[model samples]
Target chain A: MKNQELPSLNYVFLLKQTTLEQPFISIKMMIVQQILFVIISIVAFYLFAKKASEIRRNILLGRDEDLTDQSEKRWKNMVLLAFGQKKMFKKPIPAILHLFVYVGFVLINIEVLEILIDGVFGTHRALEAPLGSFYHFLIGFFEILAVLTLIAVISFLVRRNILKVKRLSMAELDGFPKRDANTILYIEVVLMSMLLIMNASEGAIMLQEGTGNGFLISTMLAPAIVGLSPESLHLIERICWWGHILGIYAFLNYLPYSKHFHILLAFPNAYYQRLTPQAEMRNMKDIQNEVLYMMQPELAPPPPADGSQPATSAFGAKDVKDLSWKNLMDAYACTECGRCTDACPANTTGKKLSPRKIMMATRDRLEEVGTNINQNKTFVEDGKTLLHDYISVEELRACTTCQACVEACPVSISPLDIIAQLRRNLVMEESNAPQEWNLMFSNIETNMAPWKFSPDERDAWIHS
Target chain B: MLEVKSMAEFMASGESPDVLFWVGCAGSFDQRAQKITKAFVQILNKVGVSFAILGKEEMCTGDPARRAGNEFLFQMMAYNNIQVLNGYNVKKIITTCPHCFNVIKNEYPALGGNYEVIHHTVFLQQLINDGKLVLKDGGAFKGTKITYHDSCYLGRGNGVYEAPREVLQALDVELVEMKSCRSKGLCCGAGGAQMFKEEEAGTTRVNFKRTDEAIETGANIIASNCPFCTTMLVDGVKNREKEEAIKVMDIAEMVALSLKDQ
Candidate 1:
């Protein structure tokens, strides 16, 4: 048993006829494993990650009202968000799990190089032999991590299942959405099981051959393959190699497009996370003051002249564009682990706000925006059509601003801020706040409190 | 030299307490919290620290209204509270409610209520550092593997996480980390006026979710800084009839327990 090696999404080359590359004639390895894997890998990795990327870009930038200008600060923010994951640690466990998965996924490059050179390029020892010592160590390490990740994810299932931590489970407490959570957990468990099983099955080969303390345990399996006919050994090697590669590929591709895409986005989001606190996200100074800022009704730089305004220039964000660059980055960083929902008092108490959903909405919207952008649509024009087109007014109002969502996010994405900004737009700019917000504003202005307690009643506590 | 102001007058004064103990409505009206405030005041007085109370001059810090979705009222209260803190020329302040602590330290600056606000636990830790009080140190309380609940305001809200535990250890209580402690500390549902309003329709209460963690410790007591936490944890104990005879108290109360005199 060596250290755990992570699943790397590299184009592995299955080369023919290295001194070590013996052809296998095993029918099971050739016919059954390889074909199903190709399809699964294709669907999971390429289709999902690409589709998710497209959808999120469009949702955030599809409109003429869009603001995905790729500024230096935004790029810096992306580095911070996509890399630092500052927001993710706000929640503890899920952050840790997601963090490992992310590192494991990124380091997949090591293996990808191996597969491309060895599997595809016809260099049997091309990849692994070169990084042999390092490779052996790395695979051993990721294998352990994969095992640990599987354990952690399993605990999440138990919490969602037996302990029944609310908001963590998507069920109506009816045991259905929970069933879905379990199913997802099962998928993860099965995938990892397949991955590790292939490694261990191969490891018997390596162990008999006798390699020690490296990541790629499969190297040891090379000797175990010695017992089998050359053809059989070759077939098993190919089967296991494809199993590992295709599993990783499917996971990567599935990541961006599916709920699980948080797997891919979580790390970068965490790494490039905001340096300031969630409570102070609005305090990050604004940069762009082009009249373009004013042209749009929402991001309008301060009003002109006497300030005897027909309508006041709004403070805070109006849409994803109106949000600070980091804020937009936060939307993209969500891992959808439901940590925020689990911590949310509102969600636990049966309120409409699901922090996970908020992230999903943002990602979905970003996708909408991305599609429009790829088509060369102006955010200003397309944004108008895309917004009320995708998201609803009711969805934005459900937030309590408890900062639970803010606090629970492992990557530290503030779905709450997004929700608040949405509320700000509806209230300040559009004059269409929920009745409570409208009353709240007036109440603060006149009575200085929301109780609507009469000014006389203010002193009900004292005889003064 | 405590300047007392009603919620009404406090709204207008625009003063700041040197260390504004931003008392919420419960601190003023709830007997248990009022006692905590008085003890808090007495502790400062014994330490020969100059201080002022928002006194009768203070009003609800708008936490209740704000948490209840009455943002309008919350702002007014916050503005009024900020005005009083400013009037006093106060910079460093403190509070017992995680809610009040959060509002002043984390949130107030956004609405013009800037000050160096700290939670009481952190402040108490400072006092200990300054040699303000002495613990009997009869040795750590044996057979009590106590776990402290990181009140949302003090822990998650402001990140003053280690101070309370230091105060606990100073009193010599064995501390065990809860399953949901520190960054992942479970909420007790006493924040944001959840103490006042209805518990937003759930299978269980937040306090119970958190308290169960404490109970699982097989510890007899749970310690915290905020009064709302005290109230909720006490309720949690009563409800579960936790076999360990677990009781909830403010960290100040814990220190008071170790004190020879008032």
Candidate 2:
């Protein structure tokens, strides 16, 4: 192989010659394989993108409001929340490990571009022909990353399945969540192992040429497989190579259905995050306008005119569509790390509220609605909503609006906002507030205070 | 301090005070919060800063109604208060309660009530910095061990952990910090109208956990900026039967106690 020139196009001849003796695949078979690969890849990509757009459309089912102000702040938040993973550092150990997986997986994907090219073009290490020396270093770096990713993935598996970390084993993580997490970890481990084994087997076959030192892990393992015949080495390398690329395609399609959708949505989610101070709740703009009209009639701006009958609505959110698109995006972007619930006072103190569940319920309801649209070609009445059907009034009321979940979210997703919106539905739309809240509400209406004191008595404390 | 005039009184006299004191519902009706109001008023008087209260014209800032999800009631109360404040041509205002300060400073502007609203801690800190309101010698709080509890509204709600501490620093007290202070501070379980309702079933009340964090600092006094926090911490101290050992006081009360008597 060292004596032979390794041009990019030579792969067809080289691979065929290696398998010439016993049941060599014909040109027709090779063409069939190439066509099948392209079809599978195209189908995978099309389905993945279709599902992603479904989620986007579902999010836009929300009422329109401009969150486009302060582009600079949004960009900074994206960098800090998603890329920098600032909030993840609260738990230093897990964060460091997660960083390994995050950085490794992200950086390692650069090599996948080449693998994808190789699969499409029927070429073997085509980049090596273009850039000779750096290609070795590139593969070497990718190999090292693969090893780190492997270690991290194994640690995650142990933490979830064996060590049983409490946060991962929480009640909400049962069923598909538990399996989904483990499945991704398993996929990662297998993909990483196949990469190393493919490299090692290729290096073993190339040992006759005295060149097997490029990949760190593979170079070390090549000696262990030195006794194996070159044909067997080639066979093993081909299987590993095919398995790795196919697994990656499968993973890509799987991501949209999993909480791993955060992998793609995190950037956009962080960019659309609420930039105002965490303590500042967004005022219901309709009510704000109404207040302005009541307080300063002459200065009140006219309501927007679309020349259509204005729809009368009870104030605040009642359905998923009443939520802002950014909030819906937050639901889709949740990584389901349980960090928010861990930090939430309500959840930690054994209240019925779980911030993670709030996000999950939102995503679930959105997904259900999306499926309805897809099936019926329009949203049919499911007679279910995100508020009372998925998330309960008790859960909504239990939140203290402490902003702890907002602060603790690694990706800057604010479940507190979602809770507030749901609570708004309960009080404004359904009149389902606790009796105490109703009392306080009446007091404010009658006396301009949460207490039952008269306005004249407000001055009594001044004299006291 | 004894003759606190209303904004209406000042207007009728052709005298506009520098700032309108928005005595919130608690400061006007809750007995414990009234002490905070008086202490803050006394400090203003000692500094010779002419300020007037909203008095009978002052309504609740509608913070509780808004938080409790009653938008209509909140808007009704908010519009009425905004009308009164804007009518007075009030350019600057201050309040002792964090809920009032937060609502007036942050929430009110959207409803056409914009003013330079400062919380009393920040106002007091400014007063001291401006060479008004000097401390007497080492001041009354000298040699006293004080731990400051960060109110959700005053601390995390408004990013004002420093102003209260700065006001307390002037008293020359030994300031011991709780484990979770500043941005990481726990709520006193009183924000978002949680004060008006029974807490949802839980293993522990938020105030109990927060007060326990404060007491763990082993300070004799738990100083706070918000009246709600003061009440919650006071109750926490009582619950632990350490009322004799631990005293809960507002930042204004601490400053007023240490003021130089005229």
Candidate 3:
């Protein structure tokens, strides 16, 4: 009987030793996992930066422009457009919901700091002791925001997929854009769920320790999983915690490849927006130089030799490289919200003109150019231009230069400028203007009016 | 009515005028728009302001040419007009057309043609404010329902909304507003040189869409400030077979009808 009791006592001792050693083994494992994720996060950042700078270099391949005027006004515009979202309020319902997601997205990122600290040092709830009671409040606040983000993202998904908003379902948004939007929504939903699961599991462990503070969401969720043993709760918590951080790192890298790149580009895009009056059209300097040479030769420089000008140096944009850097940046900065197209008179009137398409085509052509450079270390002369290859002449001519697109843009992007530049190419370089336009041009050249009548006969109506 | 003098006539007589009337191409050519020209001239005569017309020497302001993307022609016409105006040492200028107003006031300064350019609506508003042009009590348009169509040039292009509205107010008419007005105004479908070119295939005509908004106001008269807008609105009214019911008139024509002399 004494020998049997001794064996059972030894068994109890063995169980206690294993239970005590569990944390030590996990600490070692967590350190290894932490190093792995850090390496992965670094690699993801490197790739994202590489892709982002490639885009920047490609945009700079375009002609140099001076959008640097009115710095004070530009800053104010950025504040109003990007931060204040002044134009989003035009549709109040979506604006309010989007505000929730936007705010949640920014605020929730703060937790990533605590996560990195805990992951790196193998500390459990490292901030809780330092933060005291505030940690519970912080977690509760994050939980609330997580729930809101989930709701907002789901609603957005429904709007795009279920409600089938016409703006989202347009022909241009059919392929990658449609999938890209859904991917971002799904990512948000997953991330938000992981956060809740992590908190809930943590709450279960705290309850077993008899120290659960009963934070709102986690406390509510804890009761359902409270029956689970401590070991299972710890495993669940560890899995969710790792998944949430990994998902965030992946999302950071995915932005440069997505239309959601606007999340990072919108501020700078608004900061560099054209500061001139809405009705004003930019005067082409090359045309202005030629006009000065013709009208006031004394103020103009001597004309260059016929062959001195490069064959590639056309009057206006024939390709992405002929556009201003700001124009390319505008394309990269498009939120794919379709507000410009919705407000466009040409589009509204059933014309084959959509400002949204113009931006997307610009981005697509830029990507093509970028790929060409990546393969050849320079442009390979693809025999395709943004002009006839991507955007047609019919679409260019259909624009009224009404500036509705510019006005309607929540980010202050001006698709009209792109239209005007392309139109300039057609008129000045290609001489490909519509027949009526050519007739009117000649009429003005000879008669100083868009009519066949002589200038002297202009006053005929007064006599009649 | 006072006879209007030409800049050539003013130059020959060595008589300087207070203002130069830049009667634009449509005002000088379109028969309907010509009446607006004459009406505005009569107001100048009634106000006894020393105004002169460029007449035969006046070239187009090159608004339509520039808008049509013909920079060469625009510069040629602009330079010619600028040369003539500067040669006369002209200072203050007013025009009945918003196209002329926009180009001369905004585009001309860039091409070395700087002058005090004013739209006829703003000028007429000033004249009324100065007590130079008096409105008659119970005039032709008095108590009549009028909806002012915001021309792209005068309203959106130049941000001159109050002047036209104020002019309508002086006529003692019931000034009703369309749903889209002021900076949010719809185009008359004649801007950007569309007046001279056929419109591209579209779901609906912008002018007719705008006219429908005006018609929705239940106003019998559609007041306009620009010749292009007047033409488009007139065509819009005719298309809806509301021509007999709705009279499309320039603000100048409306003011002329409400003048003490008329």
Write one digit per residue (lDDT tens) for candidate 1, span B1-262: 3223433344366543345556555555556666666666556665656555555446666665444344444555665676677776677777777777676766678766678877778888888887877656583354466789887766766676798898887777788888878766777776544554455444666677777888888777788788888888888888898634777777776665565454
Q: What's model 2's lDDT at A462? A: 61
The sequence of per-residue lDDT tens digits that candidate 2 reaches over residues B187-256 is 7888778899998998988788887888898899999888888888888888888998899999899888
Best by DockQ: 2
Q: Mind giving the per-residue lDDT tens digits that candidate 2 earns over A408-450?
A: 7888798988888777778888889888998888888788778
List ranges where model 2 is wrong by over 4 Å: A1-33, A291-309, B1-3
- Against the true two-chain complex, what DockQ does each candidate achieve? 0.14, 0.67, 0.54
Task: Give per-residue CA lDDT, model 1, range A10-64, as digits (tens).
Answer: 1122232332342353344344444564555456656766676564554344222
Cα deviation at A288, candidate 1, in Å, is 19
| Candidates 1 and 2 compared by DockQ, better number | 2
Ten residues in a row with the worst lDDT in model 1 chain B?
Answer: B1-10
Deviation from native of the Cα of residue A454 in model 2, angstroms:
2.1
lDDT of 3 by residue, A1-464 (tens): 99879987886677567679977877778879878877877887798889999989988988888888889998998999899889889778789888888888888889988888887777777899999999999989999999988988999999999999888889889899999999998999999999998999888888889986466787789989888767678778889988998898789888888899888888998998876556666666566667777666798755476748533367678899999999999999997899888867678788888999999999999999999999999899999999999999888877776776787788778888888778877887788888888888888777777778888787676557
In the range B12-54, model 3's lDDT, one tens digit per residue, is 9988899999999889888788899999988888878898998
Q: In model 2, how large is the Cα lDDT of residue A109?
A: 85
